[model samples]
Target: MAIIKAVNSKSSIGTAINYVSKKEKTEEKLISGIDCNPITAIDEMKATKELYDKKDGRQYSHFIQSFNPKDTLSPEKAHKIGKEFIRNNDKFKGHEILLTTHKDKKHIHNHFIINSVNYETGRKFHTTKYEYQAMKDKSNELSKDHGLTVPEKTKEKGKITSFNQNKYRVMERHFKGTARSYVIDTALAVKKAQGKSTSREDFIKEMKDQGYSTNWTDTRKHVTFINNETGKRVRLANLEKTFNDSNFTKGGLTDEFEQTLGRRERSRGTKSIDSRNKGVKRAYEELHQGTDGQGLNQPPSSLKRDSGDRRGKQKGTRANDFDIGRAKEHIRKSASENARSLGELSKPDARTRKIEQEKARELERANRRELERRIERNKSRNRENTR
Candidate 1:
């Protein structure tokens, strides 16, 4: 399997590029063997580095690479897969790209170095927030072509294999009560809503309304939570505590309250598997579809996933490229008028300019509000599952 790593380090870009180019296979071998000809590896690196380091005079640098070891994968196969990936992602055409493989890891993986500059405009590339996930998803899709084992969507807890359990244990210890808090709060909210005896069915509905989520870990057999607020891994025991907390139990709430509580419960933990499962079968059904939660499916519906599916506006009314262009033009015109006119004569024009400025300001304010709303919504939705 190939693992993709994209870095925005000014100092590391060159080191990373060179390390992949010369450290593993000779620079010539990479260029000749890889199908990305006319788009040579060295030239690709140089072009990408130049644009990322020079354009807009912004010192911010970024290079993305995909790593797959050579022991498990032949350079020939890796090169083909890399070329295919680039061909499929045509929108990334203008950017410089290099495909390389290393001999260091267990599974052979390839590295893709890309300059984060938009070739058409000689401007910095606006990397999307979901770019990494998109890359992983694409990589997974490509793996099928090579007859490689395509990783299935796994719960965050399930992903903690023996190799990485210690790392997770450390995180779980440090972020104590983080993920579990949400689950506990949701359970408590459900209980309080029904006068200390909420039905499991009602609790599940409340959780769904609020967009909370729950998942089973086939490896661990734990009902893990993706806390919406903390984005931490929450085990089931923590949920029990948050529910018993005084603040949630004392108040009477509607289905909305249960929904909100449910959302909080599921959002505490974050795992890539969660995103992968967005379009898959429901978590509850996956676990309880056949047998009760006792078998492979451990935790049943008192812990329903609040799917977090409801949608709202994203990217608040912030100015677009066109709006910014107009504002710049207005400012230039206003500046010229001030330079040419007498102080008194300029008063009317200045007032008119001021009105234009206010319009721009209003648009900007609306833009900010819209962006903020989207950000909050994204944060909330992100917490809906444990990868």
Candidate 2:
């Protein structure tokens, strides 16, 4: 099996060219070039790039085609396959390419450094997702043609990110032998609770139900969890990297709470949007029709998801704060305008006081109306379910 990867080299063109074609790693016999000389590949590529005036940014593209160690393919065979793959690929036909097969490692890997500027038309070689995936497919097809068996492809793990990697790796080292690990146990419990709970308060209650005490408040920078039975206390940050998800870090839980609650703080918690919209529309119609903002008893009817679905389910939508705030502001302005249109407000006295007061009154009535509407709707559903 041969796996292809594109390398985004940060070093300058010359440095990258030297590293890939280093004499100790690969020999002149195993190296070849396309539209450029392998011995002077770097100069040829630089000259091509300089001619096109595209030397300001990227100079060349580096691609690595590595074969499986178990394949036991000879350097000559791998080099032949590498040249064939590149020549057959339409994306690199017009570009200057340097192919080197390195035998220093356990597996033989072929390196291809293609000039950025095309030799034929001076056009810069650009890579897209489609082109990259096609290269992989072509390379794999050739590998299979040579009677090599490709292993099943698996999801690639994330590369080591620059941020706090060393610090997190330190914690990961401490978490070795986690079979009876206390901190690991707490993190598992925290993730379990976060999966089910929507609000910070709900999360806290869920943790309590699991017999874990959390100092996880919005104001604090770090949360510490204490196992009730084991009496083991550990800061959330001290846990392994896998357990330390962004949702349970710092004000993450509170941020999620604020988003989930959305415009439903007055109703204690938020429900599915499908039901919320219905309640809001019903309340608006009732307020305008006859209730005069009085008989509105419908808050949004919440459809509780099955508890079984909540367990082990981590995926959820995060509410957009800007849209939610805009929606809330729209309601207040709309209520104020409606009151004014009905001639209920006097510009002299009500301009400063009564408009705000009327907006509040209408909103309160709408909320109450929704609450009552949901209760009646639930009773009806329950009666049918019993039947």
Candidate 3:
């Protein structure tokens, strides 16, 4: 696993550059620079800093990328990975960077020295905790591409997945400061709550007890949640990934609730074609299975007969206004035109078609000849002008 660390160094930039770019510890070939020449990087950096008029307390920012010794990695690959680590990070976009790969130590590592003042914008480099995590995330990405070792993430506070000493690697980047990040975070917390609640009511109650106002109903299009204290509302449908194809277009909270209960009561829920035993399964089926326990897959039956045809359009709504006689007349006229067109296609004239094709070919040939003549005239005119 490649590990990355960043430190704001108060020491001299020249001293760090010399220590990193030493030929005995690492070759000049391995030492590279971004937006500047490695051999005269210090001079170039000083010029940029002076251009920005940054007479400074902090000289440069330092970063270290060290690799796991257990993995067999080459120097070139390691250097390439280190370069990518800088290039891929958006924070280092306009900064001049000095990168050197050291092979002298048992554990191969790369040193990154960056100019504090950006060349183009003259902006000083600054980093926060979030920015450091972003760098670590980038390092993990580059390391994975090269099949290098990557360190497992440490557990964060407030998340409850670290029980039983289990290593849990879930969730992903909440991109672009969008609402989807909060929705996914809510899903993780809700999933943890679901693990303890056995029934649908119990699950909703648990979420309420946890201070999340449950807005999930079987028919509601969005399984929304409201934070009681903060008064923040988020829709699970906002994530746009329901992950279920059935009728539960919302978060499928109801389905999840019932499924968990079913898994728990498998002994009493399984019927096994034994009609003699009336178990909890029957009660569950009656509750979720259709209206009046008709069957699990049966659709809800209406007490009154439907007024419309098989299309479900109400009887007096549109059927009464539709003109069947006008429709029949329209169909008859369309058939007549179609038959006339088919009859026209049956009669063919070969000589007329051949004459049209010949006329097209002759016109194309004349255009090509005229183009060639124009090219020859231009060449002759150029030769005369040159002489």
Error of 3 at 82 (Å): 0.8
- The alpha-carbon RMSD values of the candidates against the true structure, listed in the order shown, are 24.9, 24.2, 23.4
Which 10 consecutive residues of model 1 have the lowest summed lDDT? Answer: 243-252
> Where is the poorest 10-residue window by lDDT in model 3?
160-169
For candidate 3, what is the TM-score?
Answer: 0.42
For model 2, what is the alpha-carbon lDDT of residue 150?
59
TM-score of each: 0.37, 0.42, 0.42
- Please give, for residues 1-387, the per-residue lDDT of candidate 2 as tens digits: 887766756687778777877889999788776765665667666666554556776677888888888886999999999989998999997787878899999989999988888866789887754576688789879989998755343222221111133444544454454335455456667767765666767888888999988887658867888888988888866652333233445444554566556545655544456688899997655444321232233233311232344575636422211344446788999999998876755566658687789899898677656644543454355345435
What is the alpha-carbon RMSD of candidate 3 to the true structure?
A: 23.4
> Cα deviation of 240 in candidate 2 (Å)?
19
Give the winner by lDDT: 2 or 3.
Answer: 2
Q: In model 3, how large is the Cα lDDT of residue 84?
A: 92
